[model samples]
Target: MQRVLSCFFALFLGLVPLASADVEVKAPDVLVRDVTNEVLEIVRKDRAIQAGDTQRVFGLVQDKVLPHFNFRRMTMLAVGRDWRNATPEQQGRLVDAFQTLLVRTYSNALTQYRDQVIEFRPVRQTAADTTVQVRTEVRQSGAQPIGIDYTLEKTEKGWKVFDVVVAGVSLVTNYRGSFGDEIRAGGIDGLIRSLEEKNRSLETPQGAK
Candidate 1:
């Protein structure tokens, strides 16, 4: 679990400006390679990030990484079948909580960056396709390579990632079970509270460690 989380942050090593207003079929592939290269440089050179500066890392993630993601879709997917039952306000809260949880989680893992290299695999998609998967591998020293895949969809603005797959484990899939349990145990509000509590812990001095 720790290793997978560590490699997951490997994908955020780059922070380039967004792709064109309308991303092409090959845009996701290019986005992965280009952003990873940029993020590598950021991680490699940023002293604050390397030193585990939570605010700095969080800021970078919010400004650079979050923009490329479709957090609403991600939140809905993780919430599973209960999504339709969630009210508009509840859904909004869920998105915020889920997004915050991911940002903090990835930010912490990002401090473990160590000049890892990413190699993107060929994208298999037709030109007319609206959704596609961008595959890649993370190469690290003294460790086995890990598979990282991004699932992106073409929106009116551009290509945005909805989910990330580490090895064969889907980010949404992994969260769905736990989130479902929370919803069943305490309802949507309960799940929201749980996520909010988790995010609050990450904000504390001890949780930052």
Candidate 2:
């Protein structure tokens, strides 16, 4: 699961600025397919990212990939019922910390890119539906195909991804157990502090390690 999750970040590579404007009107599946192609092309051509430029990778993710995600909702879901126990300020901190943790932890995936085939399944959704799942599969030679599914909601801004399930494991759910442990040990503030520490520890590039 961890290996698949690590490979998942590679999909975020090479996001171009031009795609931002069209996101609001594009269907969920179309958006995923287009962005995946754009990102893959950029990753293939950028030598810096291929050489493990952590700063550049992190910047691209913050600028391009993050806009497509609803981090606050992701954090809330990951934290489960404990989310309501947090104050507004603490909730904001949790969102920031979780976002940072993800970016820092997976930023190095830019350097690990292999030419894996990505297959997008036909989307099942209607115009009246506000939430939909965009399913995809990653195929690599000698390995079983891994399923990656994006759960998105139609917000005023566009379709924002609130959760990702990789190989049947929900990303938020994967963290929920550890988050619950932290909250039980020290409260919401403790979870924020723990995430901050994890982010800091991951500041160095994975390649460097």
C-alpha lDDT values of all predictions:
0.81, 0.82
Which structure among the candidates has the greatest TM-score?
2
Residue range 1-209, candidate 2, lDDT tens digits: 66877866766442233566787767888878887887787677888877787887788788877887899999999999999989999999999999998887668766778688888999999889999998988888998988888899999988888888888999999999999999999999899999998888778653443
Model 1 over residues 1-209: C-alpha lDDT tens digits?
A: 65796678656545344454424433678767776786687678887777777777787788777877899999999999999999999999999999999888878787777777788899998889989998998887898899988898888777888988998899999999999999999999999999999998878353245
The TM-scores of all predictions, comma-separated, are: 0.91, 0.93
| Residue 28 miss distance in model 1 (angstroms) | 1.2
What count of clashes does model 1 give? 4
The whole-model C-alpha lDDT of candidate 1 against the native structure comes to: 0.81
Q: CA RMSD for every model? A: 2.6, 2.3
Q: Given candidate 1, what's the lDDT at residue 141?
A: 87
